[model samples]
Target: MIWTIKKAIYRAMHGSLKVMMVLFNLPEPELFTGAGSSLKIPEVVKSKGINNVLVVTDKVLMELNLLEGLFNSLKENNVEYKVFDDVSENPTIQNVEDGLKLYLEGKCAGIIAFGGGSPMDCAKAIGARAVNPKRSVLVMKGLFKVRRKIPPLFTIPTTAGTGSETTIAAVIKDPDTHEKFAIVDMKLIPIVAALDPELMVGLPPHITSSTGMDALTHAVEAYIGVCGNKLTNENAEKATKLIFENLEEVYKDGLNLEKRNNMALASYYAGVAFTRAGVGYVHAIAHNMGGLYGVPHGLANAVILPYILEFSRKDAEEKLAGLAIAGGIGTPIESNEELSYRFIEKVKAMNKNMGIPSSIKEIQIKDIPLIAERAVKEGNPDYPVPKIMNQKECEGIIRKLLP
Candidate 1:
């Protein structure tokens, strides 16, 4: 069966990679799986012998009283902590600087990225600053130049989007320039990721919907990306299914525990898949738009997903067909093009069902030149994304949403 072959390939790749790591000087992330993952916090901190932790969170988390359980657990374990609730949606360089000041001043042993991606990213930047405070974090933009070993770090994601919890990248927008920059060193990757569905139970419907679409975008990009290995493929496929089946139900009823659990798990798997396989032009472009426009990350991904898929369908047919099948479209389609288009249409329909906007104009449609130009140059350059687009092509993708 296909599932059997996929399972076998995943095992072989994971196994051989580990073997070569010790024998051939290869490197990768420290793999940790957390199904019932809450206790992982204590485990990783204790294992690393981290005596004190600076919990980087945000205002909403502190206001809504969402962090009580985790704080209680840390208190019970005798872990000294400080709270920094200043991180914003698109985290700024100032946010990182302030957080880093707190981290150093508290003399915390490690970091706990205890909120969504913004706080998580702030935590990474704070840790990176701790090691090499003099270096311009902006100068270390693209790959593997994180100069020093950061302190022991852990991430607990309260929402499902952005996956900064498990990824080796942190996106911070410079307040002075209002241009987004990402630091993609392996040092940014967390030591352990804690995915607790209970934490997401408080998410409002709008946040739930947008974050779910973010996960869906991750799977779509990973499945279709050129660098997709067998392991990434399996995770993407399973994550796609989980999102399509559960995202809408949870949107309509945010209190649905089962759907929340499914979305949380899907978000984690999507993070793992995209971390290895790489995201595509949608993400690259979306980042620019978010930085410039103040649009939410997931909302940007949701609005542009179908339009970008339509543009890339011819080049990404086979992979798009795989996603179509995963989304429950059958082989009865007349042609590969038709199948791919149908899948795009299905995503649009899903977005509609979840109350997402049908076009970029809904959130933003400005600074086309800057957004398109920077998209190609940012975030992912190493992986094999399906599309090989130039500036004109990127501009065209932007024009689709223009009024």
Candidate 2:
């Protein structure tokens, strides 16, 4: 009876929220996609009328020379900037505070988020803090909690994943609690996004595989999730097809600029899809794994994705079958269930080919209940997952992934 009441309350809340979002008609960022799109950063900066900017990045991207074009563009345009390169793989509240300090100390007029999701998330948090200086970042943890407009922000994604460039959500961790939370608001979206495949050409194969799978997960979940609309469904289908076609090629030959560009577009499309439809249990569980075990976000999602799909298969059978057709994994004659199984098999095969492990060896059996509880709390009433698992069912999925 308690579960039934909770579910009813959630359904009512979710429906109301959806209605409000539809009424709001929020706007997304302007996107530039191509081989050398990062070179347009200075132009965007100039257009936004920002002279001093904060560049949020990580050490590895700087060391890899991925920011050469961006920095050179800023230099040529005579734009002064400060760099905060201490963002971690799973950025923490402390990281956001540190970046905010840099932003304030440097008196930045805008922000340039450079690198993957970590830097972008940190940049968004910093921007949010800059706008609401008196408010705690913790207070901005839930949907539409950010009430004010953030500073003009531009995103240059160095990897072909995470889609943080186009999304209005930022996931930040709390060190004290060892938990991850999201700051979701249209105000947190970037003013511009540059998807330059040139920066992704030198990415390590393992990173490429994992990040590509992250994009795939986004597309799949968006399609299967209940909130999907016509536009989001179309974007998700195209993104899934692009990932299926180009991900392995990009993984094998990272320097193939065409395939790299395709993957980048795929990630952006998937980002757009999920930004509206929202992601499901895969991300909720993966976020917990990152907070507790320090698992890389993309790898954790990749490892747990197939299991979630299997668990949700009954609820999402028709959608899964459609994805199987879209992904070129099934024929028109196949039944929905058969096609869904084939699609799941295709995902497993892709993971195997990309060398993703079947299970995470670090997950302890004792942590299953805690993770499951957290996952349910995180996903329920927010994500439009086709199947909403209880704590016991969530634990079963976790056990399957445990070594």
Candidate 3:
């Protein structure tokens, strides 16, 4: 009876939050897409009267010379830029502080996030810290805390996942507590985004598979969550279909620019959907894994998605059936029960074929309790999941992933 009452209260809060989001009419980034879209950004930055910029990215991408074209374009456009390539895989708060120092020293007028999610997240945090000089990143944790406007922020995603380019979130980790949290506010949304498939064609097969699955998780969680509206549902459905059609094809043939382009679009759509509608326990759990074990975010999401779906399958049955049909895995004539099971099976098959493991080797038996606590804390009263799980139930689910 107590649990039932708590769920009812949670549902009421979710309803109120959904109404507020619809009325707010959140904005999306101005987009540049296709094979050479990233080069267009320098011209736009110049037109915006941004004389100097900070480019945030990871060292691996710098070593790969992946940013060579963007750098050349920035030079040609006369946009003075400083590069901060110290961002980590999960992007620590220290990375943000270091980047902010570079932004200040370079007298940068704007920011260009030029890698995967880590760079984008680090860039967003730097912007937030720059504008709100008195507020620490830890203080800005949770919703609507960053009231100040960030500098002109532009994002270019090298990976077709995380959708950090389009999302109103900047996920950062604290090294001391090993806690990963998000700073979610409209202020963090990028002013512009470039989706260039050329930059994605060189990604390794494992990175390609994991990131594609991450996009699918975003779409699935958004569509089945209670906060979804017409726009989010449409975007999620389109994203799901595109991911189903293109992810594996691109994974097998990483050089296929057309398939890569499709996956990029799918990631953007999923990002847009989840930004407004909210994601569920998969994200909550994945964030914890990234924080605790230093697991890559997409890899953790890829491994945890199927387990979360199975846990919520009964409650999300009709929605999963709809997604099954939208993803071209089931017909409209199929029963919801059958379709739902088929959707879960399809996710399992995708993981298996892509060489993603069913269990995470980094997850230790002793840490299950802590992970479950943090996951439930992050998820409940915000995620609006189809089913509300307590810590005990969450522990049971996490235990399955122990290797």
- Provide the TM-score for each candidate, comma-separated: 0.88, 0.98, 0.99
TM-score of 1: 0.88
User: lDDT ranking from best to worst?
Assistant: 3, 2, 1
The segments of candidate 3 whose C-alpha lies over 4 angstroms from its true place after superposition are none
Off by over 4 Å in 2: none
Candidate 3 local lDDT, 240-346, one digit each (tens): 99999998888899999999999999999999999999999999999999999999889999999999999999999999999999999999998999999999999
What's the lDDT for candidate 3? 0.94
Better of 2 and 3 by TM-score: 3
- 1-403 per-residue lDDT for model 2 (tens digits): 9989887877776677656656766577888889888899898898778899999999999898778888889999989999999999999999999999999999999999999999999999999999998878899998888979889999999888898888889999999988999999999989899888999999999999999999999999989988788878888999999999999888899999999999999999999988888899999999999999889899999999999999999999999999989887887799999999988988899999999998998899889999999999999989888887789999999999987
Sort the predicted structures by TM-score, highest score first: 3, 2, 1
Number of clashes in model 2? 0
- Clashing residue pairs in candidate 2 are none
Span of ten consecutive residues with least summed lDDT in model 2: 17-26
**lDDT per residue as tens, model 1, 69-179:** 778778777788988899999899889889888988899989988888889988988898889888766766666778996787788888977777777778888877667
CA displacement after TM-score superposition, residue 34 of candidate 3 (Å): 0.2
